[model samples]
Target chain A: MSAVGGGFGRCDAPRATARLEALTPFDRAGRRATESHASSRQLAGRTATITQDTSANPGDLFYLDLHTHSTDGSDDAGATVEGYLRWITGRRRFGYRIDGFVLTEHRRFDADRDYTALAEQYGVTVLRGIEVETDVGHVLVYGVAPGFYRDFDVTNVSLPYEDVFRAAREHGGIAVGAHAGRPRIGLAEHVDRRSVSVEGVGIVEALNGGSSDEENSHALHFAEEHGLKAVGGSDSHFVSGIARCLTAFPEPVHSVEALVEALLSHEYRPVAVEETHDDEEIRERSRRLQAVRSTAEAVHHEGGEVEYDHSVIGVEVEIGSAEITHEQIAAYCESTGDTNPLYRDEAAAEAGPFGGLVAPPGLLSALVQGRGPDPKVQYGNTTFMSGQRMEYVAPVRPGDTITGYASVKEVYEKTGRSGRMVFVVNRTRYANQRGEDVSANESSMVHRQVAPRKES
Target chain B: MSDAITQRYFEDVWPGDEYIEEHQPTGDDVAEYLHINQMGRRAQTGNLDGRFTDVAGAARQGLARPIVPGAMSMALITRLVTDWMGPLGHLRSIEVSFRRPVQHDDRLRANALVTDASDEDGEPTATLDVFFENERGERPVQGTAVVVLPRRTQPAPVVE
Candidate 1:
């Protein structure tokens, strides 16, 4: 139910508006349910009528970042598809214009993963491309087809540039040289020093976000002399660097096929994110986004310093255990007023299911109270339990010994209305005497700095 | 544990289907929960001094009135799910976040909404958004639950 392939270009006016109006409530609810696990395909089916207004002038340019990487499809990338969408949503909320971004993950294209639902949720157009290495350097490919995959080994570090370029065009795709001015990996350097001639190459990346100023200048000049059109890409492996450099198209582009047509037909130009976005907001938000990367990294806030002991993460330790006895089961039932005969009267329970007495599932909460390694999160002076998650695999029967193993699952910081807060998640796994997992739980604790109260 | 309650099948549910149950926990209910949990003896309690059960104890922790114990709230939620799932349905996991306090004697509405249903990996399961709401329209406790329910086409697992 998204505008992925339909929103771009001028369509029937009155009909599109009517369909959009009918789909508005569903789309809004979908967005509000942030944790809704509705798959992209389901969302696409649900919001098929969601579309951008045709009220805009057809002459208006649509801006898109042509190159980016995400952790889902690239090993070297640190940003997730959702993370990029969140950061982009943050920028768009401030009235900045960033139409969309292309996830040109290095060496692979996940054709099965559809991001149409995410795009509709974030109100940002999401598309996919691939960045591949060749004999001349790295190439950015868009609108890839099944034939393109059969023609080239994208993982190869020395793919023939001419054939890759020819095959890309033959398969209804377009290829552009990536980071064209960098040494060893740039087509500009190879062309200048080794006289490497890449035929039918009409585009090269001129403003790669990761490249130096001198390198970009060299690329810009190389494109001018070669009569090749220039595009810009962030080449970002991190979420904050997304859309640092962008390409402006003279027409709407809502899909990879449309993107290819726009790039080939329109005379596009490169634009930097700083040209339109507020520089300070970018810096502050980027800082906040990057701060959540690792526990070893720290971010200062007005309330206090936020950091944690990262060493305890993933390190497991024995948190002790307890053997479930019939007496213990009876006590648990008595405490909770759960007079179910299965847990209280052992002989009568034998005539019923479970063969004998069994402890209530909630007994795991009381039994696994052993202490584990503290993350020592350094944030607010006040700390409290935020929540608890328990996964029960099997019932606890009498005489079964249950052991708990604990570890620090994760630690991170978030800024909320109350002020800056740090969350530490500790996880514990409970196993029976037979070494079968009985259950697992994660306890989340929030640490916040409470200001001193004024005397009444 | 009872034969009177019919089993709920995975196919019989859909996202947004809601289940509601209300409870008004009195002072005695709170007291029983405290004694059952042993208030402090079992674990390192941070209630200042009986804050969860006594007003004087709660006042010391800046609370005007005694609040319902977190474990009691979790137990209520678990019971809500168990009652709905029936004997054939299994409660795989439940996670709860306590946003605000539920005061003693306050009528609490426990709600469970099926958020998603899937048979991925051949194990039919349903995800639910569970919460406790006071009359003030505040969700004092909210979380998610994942459960495995019997499929009508498949025979129920035998309890030996």
Candidate 2:
């Protein structure tokens, strides 16, 4: 018991379980004291009045979801309590270890059906509760006894809101506004209509899975304006929404007595469980992205061309594109470790054989980059540039806009010493803006599916 | 006799010598390299195509997010040592450990530090420690290499 004590930390805990456990509906004998029991209202309510505690003990994390619906006792319900339990703890759910839920049937409560066996079978707890539809809105009743049901006909819709809360109070039970902002039945809509004081409505379900965020916020704000405890519930009629919204107690609330104690506490907060990730990972990714973008821009400006596509073998695509200039020619020469005075010095070039600093042969790569069609093949994304057959048609000079286009000329499969491979023949033609063919490049790309290497 | 291959000999090389150079991976270069490997198919490679090509796909998978392949890191590590060795040297053995993922658009710099030198089988060998670090101070790749160099007396080993 100590291991599960003082959980969600901000909410109150059971100071004396000995006194509270006596009021628990499920007893050691697996029997409920629902028949004609005396109102332990003073003993229960007073002992459970909340204390102004801000920090809840870690062990007090009451993992129980306080609101759920079932077809077991309601004709309008879609899901069974048993099925809901399976899903709440199922594999697809990424189960957060939800302990139990209160089976709140609409306008109904069945004391004869002891869910003790079912709860044990599913390894979860199911407390008996009711969602009574009053003239104002729906209200959830916890700590409901068979005696209270016998005393009042709960099926009556016109049951005065004030009188119901008073009767619930007299019998040592709680009635919270369910889905506090859900239009007609919501507590917020009937706020000014109810003749009861704020004390009559002790709590409002501030977070309901079915309600919009705006509605939940309105309910929360309403609770703040009026001194009432704001709790949360899934208001779920089926699976999936079970623990999305929960009333996080300061301590584990495994039974009706513990729940009552925590509900009356000053600090049980409505919490929404959501996914969170590390900020460091996000920041590191951002840094890498910036670096890549800048480098790519610089690489493009440096006259290096890039292939735009490589999906289909026969499809024509742009492999590279570059505008040739004297500066670009010089930079290309410098990169290749070429020290030809004919290409570097303009005055010396005019006095030389070719005249006017004719661009070198290697300068063809930079002058006519790619802005033409490049083809892709159907091998694995791993291809080997096996061979290149290029023929120089004419000398490319400075200030020529060279565009290169490539297409699959031929493709054949062969089994060789390197294993089976698809040989893709690609033909690339470089043309200047003047429509003169600059160079013709025929290459073979080996298409092979090489498996990713295992990290050794 | 100007460059190291034509001028410098193995006897002139020394341990504790270090050199560093910057590497920048652009989207275009990565795209081109990856495209060159595409086995011309009607369909496409699954995760690698988008993950290594587009920013959106890369961002989805945290490791592939940099769109940099582990093989690329290994290649850089090899180049780091090779670029320093020149034509007068022959690489004998290389070993490396990939520390993290590299991505396209990373500011990478490779550092080669000559760690040891010795005569193995009458050959003058220099062992170098190589590592690449990105701008965020993450060492994505690190390795060591042993290369046999041509001495004033002994001939350099031939490359296979």
Best by lDDT: 1
True contacts kept of 2: 0.00
TM per candidate comes to 0.50, 0.36
CA lDDT, candidate 1, residue B127: 66
Q: Which residues of candidate 1, in runs, are more than 4 Å off? A: A1-114, A117-301, A330-356, A379-381, A450-456, B1-6, B39-48, B158-160
lDDT of 2 at A406: 70
**What are the runs in model 2 whose C-alpha is more than 4 Å off?**
A1-60, A91-95, A193-196, A275-456, B1-160
Please give the clash total of every predicted structure, in order: 5, 43
lDDT of 1 at A105: 84
Q: lDDT of candidate 2 vs native?
A: 0.53
**Whose DockQ is greatest here?**
1
Return the clash pairs for model 1, or none.
Answer: A1-A44, A1-A47, A1-A48, A380-A448, A380-A449
The alpha-carbon interface RMSD of model 2 comes to: 30.1
RMSD each, Å? 16.7, 28.4
